[model samples]
Every structure is written in structure tokens, then in C-alpha cells.
Target: EAAKVRLADGQGREIACDGVLLTGQFTPESSLGRQSHLQLDSGSDGPKIDQYGRCSDPAYFAAGNLLRPIETAGWSYREGRRIGSLMALALCNQLPAPHDALTLKYAAPIKLGVPGRLVRGELAGLQHIQLRVSRAVSGTLRVRAQGLDLWSRPVSALPERRLLIPLKELQLPEHLDQLDICID
Candidate 1:
């Protein structure tokens, strides 16, 4: 006898409904980046980027949620802006020429680091080597180059978060042959 629709049942009582609102969590749309074959972060659902937001492909760049599932709008905007500026520098030949890039691989539970590739002469700053773990761990975080131990430290890894690696303290060679990061 009523025109209103019932929303749901509560203890055998019907509740009135004004309208149905579809709500759900959002996810990052990284299909284009993935389709382009850019290196993806092991712990995240988006492309990996260097400090300047350059992807494995020097010609490509990513920032914000495109490089990770979640990030603040301000952070993303600043990142993109910085990357754009860097790109302009590169294009204008103001920055150093592109150098040989090294790739970092990880083992179980250790997700991929951002800027998966390290270009020669490029810096690995105190906060540049960010990592994410799938679960909690207590182990050695080892970084090696050319099969020689460069840096290692004990860490308490956590899930769904970023963990920074301090590479500047290692005093890596200006031109690296092979560089890697792992946990054991």
C-alpha cells in the first residue's frame, strides 16, 4: 500500500530507503603504464619511478598514485612538477647525459624498490631507496654491487608501507656495474 521501497531487514522489520548509493573503495588505474611495459613496483600496483619520477624508460615519467596505489594530492602534484622540471633540464642538455642503468631485484616478502634501475652517476639518496614488504620481518637488508657487499643493515620490515634505504652512506662507485638489494 506504500510507494516507498524497503532498504533492508532489521530484526524482521523493514527499513525505508530514499535511494541506493553504490559505494566502494577506489583502485589505481595503472593499465596504461603496465601496458607500456614500464617496470612495476613489486609491492605496489603501479610503475616504479626515480626521484624525478622517471620510469625505466627515460622518455616516460610517472608520479602520484600512478607510481603507487595511494598518495596525497599535494605530494603527487609536487612530484609531477619536479619530474617535469627535470625532464626539461634533460631535454635542454643541462643535466648529465643518460648513463648505464642497474636493476634491483628482491626476494620473497620484499617488494620492488622505486626507480628499479639505477643510472650511473645518479645518486641513491638517504631516502631514495624506498621499499615495501608484504609482511613483518626481522632480517638483514643487504645492498651489493658487482658481487661485492656495499651495504647491509638490520631492519624491522612491516606490511603495506614504505621503508627507506640509506644508500648515500655506502659511498657507491660513480659508475656501477651491478647493483642490487635483498633481504635475508
Candidate 2:
């Protein structure tokens, strides 16, 4: 079976594949929170929350993608578990006021991808990029300014290839707390 979705441009198209995969982007769907008179802050790439996973409203709490856009599934599960514990304590009247430091330290832009490039002379070939994780599950990728890297399993084992192109990390003002990727 096929499915078709009308785009904002009013163009018509249909997918001939048997299955479709959807990716999550940063689009705040906090209408419920807003309608309920809860404080809303769309300043960050994701929803704003204190360390305890509490939203602007003391009674309302949030977790997962609703709070922040994390690429790894492991981080989402951890956040969910933490929020659950906090909610349970709040319900039992055993938890104190929430603290941001106590909340999980989430790494922004969990995934990075680079595109293939060709240069001349010594820099003609592609540079070898490597990611070294400081923690068991955390790491940094070292690559040239412009280079391409793959981030998917073998095609024979996986139907699609996930390519991760490397770009430079930017230094933002101290006031900002999130990472932003600017692709040229």
C-alpha cells in the first residue's frame, strides 16, 4: 500500500514503499500546557525545565522529546525514569523543591554527520575522522573542517545508509546553554 501527504506548497506526492519512517524535529507541541495556564518557554531548542523535570507550572511535569530533542534512545529512557521518580515523590509529598543541577546533564547534538568532500594536493583525499568517547557511551569526533563520515550499519544488513557529515563546533556566548549546528 502507498500513502500520500499534502505539503505546505500544495504539491501532491506519494510514497511507493511498503513502510515509512518518520523523524522527530524540534516543534513545540505544548498547546495543552499553554491552554492550561502553565508557563511556556520556547527559548531553547526544546522545552525549558528545571533539573527535576518540572515545567513552568509546579503541578505540570514533562520528559522525553517533549522536554528536549535527544538523538540517542538511551538518554530518553534515562530522562523518563528520572521524571517518573520525581513525580512519584511529589505525589507522596516527600520530594523537596526541584534543582536544575540535580537533573540529568544532557549532551546536546548527540549525533553529528559530515559530508564527502574533495580537495587538491596534500589535502586532496578525505581525512580520517574518529570519535573518542570520554565516558563509556559519550565521545567526540575528530575530523577535518570539511569531511564526510558514515554513521550506519552495513547496507547488506541494513536497507538504508545513515551518513554523518562533520562540521565545526561553535563557541556561543556564556548565556546560551544549548548546542547549535550551522551547516554551510
Highest TM-score: which candidate? Answer: 1
lDDT of 1 by residue, 68-164 (tens): 6555688668767776777777677565444555666666677556656555455322136767676898898888877777888888877646677
Rate residue 15 of model 2 by lDDT.
76
> Each candidate's lDDT (Cα)?
0.65, 0.39
Local accuracy of candidate 2 as per-residue lDDT tens digits, 47-156: 44554456655586776556433334675587578778878767886644533111111122222211111111111111221111112232332221223221222211
TM-scores for every predicted model: 0.69, 0.39
Where model 1 places Cα greater than 4 Å from the true spot, the runs are 1-28, 37-45, 72-78, 122-127
Spell out the clash pairs found in candidate 1: none
Find the 10 residues in a row with the least total lDDT in model 2. 115-124
lDDT, residue 99, model 1: 51
lDDT: which candidate is best?
Answer: 1
